[model samples]
Target: MLNSEFIATVEGDKVPRKYFDGRGMYIYVQPSGAKYWRLKYRYEGLEKTYAMGVYPRVSLEIAREKTEEAKQLLIQGIDPNEYKKNQGFEIVAREWFENKKDGWKSRHAQVVIDSLEKDVFPYLGARNLSAIRPPELLTIIRRIEKRGASRVAEKVLQRIRAIFRYGIQTGRAKNNPASELTGVIKTQKVQHRKALPIEELPAFIQDVKNYEGMTSTRNAILLMLLTFVRTDELRSATWDEINLEEKVWHIQGDRTKMERPHIVPLSHQAISLLKELPSYPSKGYLFEGRKAGHSISDKTMIHALYRMGYKNKATIHGFRGVASTVLNESRLYSVDVIERQLAHIDGNATRRAYNHAQYLPERETMMQWWADYLDEAQGINQVGIVGRLKGLFSR
Candidate 1:
């Protein structure tokens, strides 16, 4: 048993003596004649303890009040012990980020990791998740924006929102501080860089064939031209998707935007080129690069055009523009037909259904004619351009 009179009279120098109070509480009598109060209790079937106060700072009556409050929580079936354990950021942040990784792209995941390292961890890593506020999050996000990374700043804000949401769900935070932050920060638009024009294409294509360069560089450019698909779609393509005999290239929806198999009707000339490829049968990538199983780098395409003496005027991607320009210029196909073949978003879903494969007959004729024109344009044949283009006229 412990009493205030005994606590007041206790004398100590270094070692402390323990005295149990009623209701699983205790008062420690230090060797220096000081008494510290500690409360021991069980809530929700688990053991827990709370420090009441150091000697003289909290009186015996004050300590009893804290013990009584903790007791009431026990009566309500809540665990104060578990509550204390849950009040940590390290545990919450880990669980939060793990559940979120699947929804992010690889590049996006990298940015989140970088921002947390540079912004959140330094200041908030040690703080309890429940303690963070909107103003606190604004301070961190503003720092990222100050470095001229507005987009990254927005991403950081989103990441913080997710963290706080996790904190709230886990009973660690009261509310998400990152909400209602749109007016606090200004958002900037993201622009995509597009390839150049097509009128100056004949000379550029000629230069590629005759340009002095590595075999891989030249072949990758040529393959990109033949496929006329997104760089990622083409680079990640496998040999299994290509059928030279059938003259068809199938791109599964996982690799495409529409989430449907996009079957590109290969031109006869395209098949001949693939047949001559060094390892079409041996490798996974049809354009297998030197980097293990991964596709060729975009740099290869960029550098190849550089070597071909098209420093700025033309690019590997410019071929698409060239094809579209020539096809539309000659009026060989309707706008809807051309747009569908280009895999552009259709304005009319009904018309798009008519050509699930994008006016295949006309596109085949157009692609073949375009290939023949390229051959003649490169002076591969002795015949003049006029003579070769004659066969391109719609029958």
Candidate 2:
């Protein structure tokens, strides 16, 4: 047996030396006096040595504990070195995340990692992936559900399932415990965002035009209605993304939710609104925030809506819902065209890949019609204009 005093005072000779701590554990000392903790063990027939840690950092007690853990693995006919190489839940989860995160948006990637770190890692990080049974994982998930975060619990479960699948593919795990735990938690009811009714569009459009908020916020609201792009997409819009000459807003794949590039055909009215914006640097965001280089906060437009007395009646995301509802009900365009303009991903990967600019001419016409319809709704009374839109959407 070795004591801390013996370890601290041990000296190295011209040749490397091993001072035994009993039970196949020893401190290996180099000729230059560097020392490391190691375990000498046999599995089946072959002899093996596993490095525990360097001397001081891994004290005698800790080294002994590690040796005991390895011995326990040996008792179960498992190789300690092999388990260390491939069995940690946290290690496998992180590898899976790194392999897949490049295709995800930066914010979404952060969210995936954050969920694992905050919810899953602390409890199961060091456990062997193959050793975590269904009940064990369900216990952790149920803990999250008990905290009243059913949605987060569901997402964590899905992520855990993915990790185990990756583990199986990589030979780190034999079974996916999370797979059997699906639907064990309650599903949260889906609450759609509050969108103004089609009949209320005229009033809502009028109120937005008359909004006495910051000019930029008012413009942001109006543009959101006109384009119906997601809030983040609109807020983060750079001047470079808008091509005035081509009458298109080219959103790069990384900026979109679907991780595919999308093209928004600019309506005449939309281009006019762009022209009216306050002069900003060509390289900066169209809707710049108070911060030097960042776009407006996500809450900027929503807070402005709240200030306009539309709280609960309308939301920033609700604009997309409103657009989708009216456009689909009008039946003035094909479903494909409408969905493409909204940047909704097509389920067919082959079609989605080649359809970024599909129906460009029809989309242009539809967008212009949408803009013209909005103009009529905003009290721009053109004889028969209101009647035509009313009749078009009457169905």
Candidate 3:
């Protein structure tokens, strides 16, 4: 007899071994340490087994009850396994989800599943796959669009289409209803991040300096202005990525939006600002959060912007736009250099491969110049040497 304690204490070895729970039910332990409860019964004189969930989750009492239920089904000339295999929708959707979820990153996979659960599953999850048609899918999609989430509606359509395609491959469905949704729905206009006008930079910079907030938050904003990197890129930055002596911040490909490793040449101001930042016990994140072992919240910068009266006028991401616009307008750097610095995709694989040192010298010069220009804009330096010299000569 298998009790809860025995079930819990069973150790798995290299070879799989089965311990009988009596009445043809046994717990099979695999070398990987997975325990599965199964019923070994002869159906029409042929031996077969029915999977009765995994251990702990199924528990001893539940497994026994399931075994008893299977015995009753056997008495009536029915197979529980076959009956379960015939079940549709939820089972098949999960089958497809489990098959493909591993390919997506955890966060992306969770979003996909959440979309399905909230939008797709409730409407069509329990329905037989083969029975679903284009009209039914369109109705669901239109309902989503009615709620003003055209993008979400489109994404749901794609997920449903993929699920149906998976169903078709597995003989669970014959046609994809979601395939017919193309051009049936409207797409929302792409909204770029709102940036303060270049003329507003002086006022914005001054306001940021005067803004009464956490010292860390003020430094974060200043760092964003100097670096022009993405909010998350800076938020999740670790101390190892920064070389104070070398004056370079190396961002690995995994952390970048373009999925390519980037080298950011730090300006003198940036290096000084970093040196002045208060160090925490954690040698990990440069910008440590309130909690240990975690970086600052994603909303930290946004909340700062809101507090500074820039809500709806500018966004944390808008700093990238400011850099792109100001750099392009200056015409002091090549488009290639600016775009590469911005980490934009150029579709030139060959150039990207061979040009790891592309414009490093130019970028170092440009970054320093940009920092000096920002200082001048904020009146950190009164006037250029040339202007002062011209004034003296004129007198």
Whose lDDT is greatest here? 2
lDDT tens digits by residue: candidate 2, 1-395: 89999889888899999999899999999988899999999998999998787878678998998899889999999999988876789999999999999887565577689889998899999887866789888888889988878867877898999999999999777788898986798876787889976667777777788988777888989999999998878998888889998999988776676767888999999999998887444677787677776678889999988887889998999988878877887888899999988888789999877865679999999998888878877764444545665777776
Kindly report which residue pairs in candidate 2 clash with one another: none
| lDDT pick, better of 1 and 3 | 3
Q: Which candidate is the best by TM-score?
A: 2
Each model's lDDT comes to 0.69, 0.85, 0.80
Model 1 root-mean-square deviation = 10.0
Off by over 4 Å in 1: 1-202, 257-261, 347-357, 380-395
Local accuracy of candidate 1 as per-residue lDDT tens digits, 103-190 = 8544335546767877788877766575565677888888878877775677677777888888888767877778968666676674
**Cand. 2 TM to true fold:** 0.58
Ranking by lDDT: 2, 3, 1
Q: Name the better of 2 and 3 by lDDT.
A: 2
Query: What residue runs in model 3 are displaced by over 4 Å at the alpha carbon?
Result: 1-38, 41-50, 53-189, 280-282, 347-357, 380-395
- Clash count, one per candidate: 3, 0, 0
Task: For candidate 3, give the lDDT of residue 8.
Answer: 94
